[model samples]
Each structure stands twice: as structure tokens, then as C-alpha cells.
Target: MKKNLFRSSSLILLVILMNGCIRGYTPDVVLKKDGQPCISIPADEDFFRRQKEFNILGLDIFQTGVGELWSRHYLDSKDHYYVKNQQCLYFNYKFQTNILYDISFFSTEKGDEENRKSTKKVWMRYMRIIKKSDGTLQLLLDKEARDYY
Candidate 1:
């Protein structure tokens, strides 16, 4: 009887540990320079595979000059933006009585020779992601231009 009880306890412990491993991992939300909550999503294989689709979606939603620039720039220099300490992309989403979603990408590098006074180069683009009634995510570029420093 004691042996059976010990086996049962061990089985239960194993199940609990396995459950944690099986669960999908979500990164923690962090604050941007502007104080908005952002959840970083790594630019892994999955993201690159869908890059074209995302750019088309952004262009279709934004339909503005700056939006066009963002779509082109993102695809061209995406690799340059990848940094170990920085997030490749981030989303800000909240669900309550109403739903709100936004996505942004930011990059900073050493300043160009022309801008010798400043030691860093920075740029950021923001867009809104809305959930359609059919449950699809739609993108919308913010009216504000990209912030550069």
C-alpha cells in the first residue's frame, strides 16, 4: 500500500512539470520610451516567412505617404534593426469593454558622419491593429510621422 501511494505521488508531480513545459510561452509586457505598454515579439523564422504578407497588410491599411515609406523601409533594412538587447517588433493590445491594438518597430544605431554631434541614430514607426468583426487583425498606420533622433 505504501509503495502504491508513493508511485501515485510521483506520477502527479511528473504531470505537473510536464504541463508547464507544454504551455506556450508569452513574453512579458515592457514600457516604451513614451510609457506605453508593449509586448515584444521576436523576429524569428515565423515572422520573416510572413514578412511580405504583413507589408501588404500595412500598405493596404495605411494608404499614406509615410505608410508607404514604412513598408519599404521595413523590408529593406530589417536585418540592420535586429539587435540582441532590442526588440525586433512589439505590439500593444488590450481587451476590455472595447478592444485596442497597436504595433511598432524601433531601431537605434551609431549616428551618421553628418550628425557628429549626436552619438546615436534612432527611428520608430507605429501603427494600429484592429480586430474586425470576422476576427481578423487589420493594421492602420498612425498619422504621426516616424520619430527620428
Candidate 2:
């Protein structure tokens, strides 16, 4: 009986540890126009630090660049994140009327300057903003489109 109890406790501990490793948060998405979805992702220190991990662990390719041209022009100067609220990263899609889309975010790192710029432009073409019924926006990676690219 003691052996069985020990096994059960070990199993429970394993499950707890596994659960703790799973990291992700539901982003608040909002639609500002007919086809434009704005995604608000956590930009806190913890979230920012986990970007590489998140990209490696998730299906979507996560990178930062300047937002859409129109949105970039209207970004809030007072906010640290700028282009949106504090402690948040704003992702907006441009040319909603057209079937094709272009997305952007500000790069937070500077290593490998030339390579980063080339890769940044390539990845931008794969991202798209999707709006949910609840008025929140989602950032999605178009794997099919990426494959073609």
C-alpha cells in the first residue's frame, strides 16, 4: 500500500511540473475597422524575455517590427511601448480591403543587424491579424503562405 501511495504522489508531482511548463496567455483582440484586427499581447518584462522560448515552443513565428504605417503614425508618444497602451504590444494589419496583408512590429533586439533586417521583412509577410466574434483580435501565422515564400 505504501509503494502504491508513493507512486501516486510521484505521478501527481510530475503532472504539476508539466502543467507549470505550459506557458501562454489569451490575448485581448479588438477590431478597429471592418477587416483590421488589433492584437494586444503582454509586453511586460517576463513576457518580453520569453519571446524566444515562445517562438521555439509555438507554431507561430513571433518577431517584432514597426506596426502598420497608419497605426505607427498615431502611436501614443507617452507610452513606453508606444503605438499602444503601456505593458502591451500592439499588432495591426494593413490593407484590410485587399486580400493580401502586411503586418509589422518594432524590433526589440539589435544583434546581427543585416541578417535581422532581411529576416524581419521575410517574416512580416507571413503574419496576419484575425478578429474574433468577441471583438478581440488574434495574430496568426500563415504556414501555407510561408511555405510558398
Candidate 3:
């Protein structure tokens, strides 16, 4: 009985230790200096060639995928996060009840303008229009985000 208990405890301890050493916490990898999250907007080459029209209208372009992944540091523990390579575009359109679609992602009052601009480096892949009164979709910056994977 004593040997069995010791063996079980040892096995449990080894499992716990291995788990800790293996894949642990992952942080967020910020790929751009702008505060905008990266996403790939679906458009053809002509779309990019027509930057004058889109860019002037605040249209964003980019590729999609996790450029890298990392862990966010915490006081006691760490949290897993990722740097997604998706492009995001923001139009200078005002808030409209009818335009309140679910395919748009709104920007929150978090990072600064510089960070927001840096976020433009990365593009948004998809968008879920949040039903918030604010129509502004601010971007995230590169300096603000750190790359992991």
C-alpha cells in the first residue's frame, strides 16, 4: 500500500512538472505601429491601385494570418495572446442606424494616434460591426504590440 501511494504521487508530480515545462503562456504579438488590428480586406489588385480613392477614404489593405504569437505578462501569471496579420479599413462615415451592420469592428479609446497609425501596417481580414454609437474604428500601433510566435 505504501509503495503504491508513493508511486502514484510521484507520477502525479512528474505530470504536473512536465505540463509546466511544456507549452505555457502565450502573449499577443503586435505586428504594426498603428493601433488598428491587422486584417485582410477582400479586394483585387485594382483595389490597391485605386489607393487614391480608397486611401483618401480611409480604406485599409493587408494579408491574413497570425504573423506571430506570444504571451501577455501578468502580475502573478501570464496570458496567451497572438499577433494576427489581418488588415482593417475605416471609412469617414458617420454613425447611421441602418448602417449598423455586424460586419464592422469599432475602435475603442485605448492607444494614441501614433499607435493607431502604426496599426495600419497590418491589414484586417474580417470585421464584425459592433452596435456601438461611436462610428470610429481606431487601429493599433506596432510599438504598442510585441510579437511572440
TM-score of each: 0.25, 0.27, 0.16
lDDT of 1 by residue, 10-111 (tens): 643553463343232232234444434444433441344443211210111121222212232332433333333224243322322112222323222222
**Clash number for candidate 2:** 7
lDDT for model 1, on a 0 to 1 scale? 0.32
Every model's Cα RMSD, please? 19.4, 17.2, 20.1
Best by lDDT: 2
Candidates 1 and 2: which is better by lDDT?
2
Residues 1-149, candidate 3: write the lDDT tens digits. 56655654564355346334322221122223332333323334224444221121123221123111111121121321222112233333332221111122212112323333322221222222222347543332232212211
Please rank every candidate by lDDT, starting with the best. 2, 1, 3
Best by TM-score: 2
Candidates' C-alpha lDDT:
0.32, 0.35, 0.27
Candidate 2: give its CA RMSD in angstroms.
Answer: 17.2
Candidate 1 — which pairs collide?
A: none
Report how far off residue 90 is in candidate 1 (Å). Answer: 6.0
